[model samples]
Target chain A: AQTVTQSQPEMSVQEAETVTLSCTYDTSENNYYLFWYKQPPSRQMILVIRQEAYKQQNATENRFSVNFQKAAKSFSLKISDSQLGDTAMYFCAFMTHTGANSKLTFGKGITLSVRP
Target chain B: EPEVTQTPSHQVTQMGQEVILRCVPISNHLYFYWYRQILGQKVEFLVSFYNNEISEKSEIFDDQFSVERPDGSNFTLKIRSTKLEDSAMYFCASRGTSGGETQYFGPGTRLLVL
Candidate 1:
């Protein structure tokens, strides 16, 4: 069984600043996929970015990027030029590369507040 | 941009009552999933369906819970007898055929069992 852990309960960042949310996972599989999802006040789960374990270049989606360390079993999300809209609960998820039948294992999530 | 849709945004039902939550996944999606989150908790996977059958389900998905795709577009989750602990936000998700394709989620149905 795979488990995701987000050690932080909450994070606060100033508008136009940067914030990084850390996460670690326990998995025996050599290759898998990781993702970051943002849930705003509207309670909608929106995909932020994804990283495949085989890719060491990391993943970047505009202002959102990730630091994926396969050896250390850690994946961290970095939000640059954070806006007030970034305030929400962010979840880190894990899924194996086991074709199409994979299910996401999610962390407890961390509430991020962007102070204006 | 196609997206998943769930009916009855919020529902309040009494204990021991039967409740069915509905979802309409993306038209081109072949895989569907159901997940739930208790307030202040992590999102928990319940079940995943493909080719008209459940491919994977978590331990949290018990005999009391069942899933179906009665028609071509509609996917539903039925709880035979709801308990107070069943209260949570249920999310419906669907994924495309590509292995790397991300799962698109619905706005979620907030179920409050009293």
Candidate 2:
């Protein structure tokens, strides 16, 4: 079974500053995918970014990016120019590439607070 | 962009009652999934469906839990006998056919068992 771990339970960042959420996983598969999801106070889980294990280049959205170290089984999310709206519970997820029936294994999550 | 939508934003049900959660995944997606997050816990996968059948399910998805894609646009999760432990946020998600595609999630339905 694959497992994702988010060591940080809670994180805070001043508005306009940057913050990084740590994530690690245990998997024997070499090809897989990693994702970062944000759940705001409204309880809506939204996709923030994704990274394919086969690709060494990290994935970046407008304000979100990931540092994916495939060999180390580490995938971290970085939020740049953080805003109050960025405050949310962030989850790290892992999906294997082998099967069409792959399911996401998620981390416990990290609560982020972008303080003003 | 298309998004997944879930019905009955919140539901309150008796401990032994049956509850059905509905979801409408993105129109073009082929694979669907149901996940649950107990209060203050990580989201856990319940089941994954494709081609109108269950493709994968976790141990938590026991006989009490079932999933169906009754139609093209709707995917549903039914719990035969609800328990207090079932009171949590349930989210529906879908992904395109492309391998390892990113999944889009619904806002989630909060279930309360009293």
Report chain A TM-scores, every model.
Answer: 0.97, 0.96
Candidate 2 residue pairs that clash: none
What does the i-RMS of model 1 come to? 1.5
Error of 2 at B28 (Å): 1.3
Task: Report the Cα lDDT for residue A81, model 1.
Answer: 100
What TM-score does each of the candidates earn?
A: 0.97, 0.97
Model 1's TM-score against the true structure? 0.97
**Model 2, span B13-59: residue lDDT tens:** 99999999999998988889999999999999999998889999999
Docking class of 1: medium
- Compose the digit string of candidate 1's lDDT tens values, residues B1-114: 888999989999999999999999999888899999998899999999999999999898999999999999999999999999999999999988866358889999999999
Q: Which pairs clash in the backbone of model 1? A: none
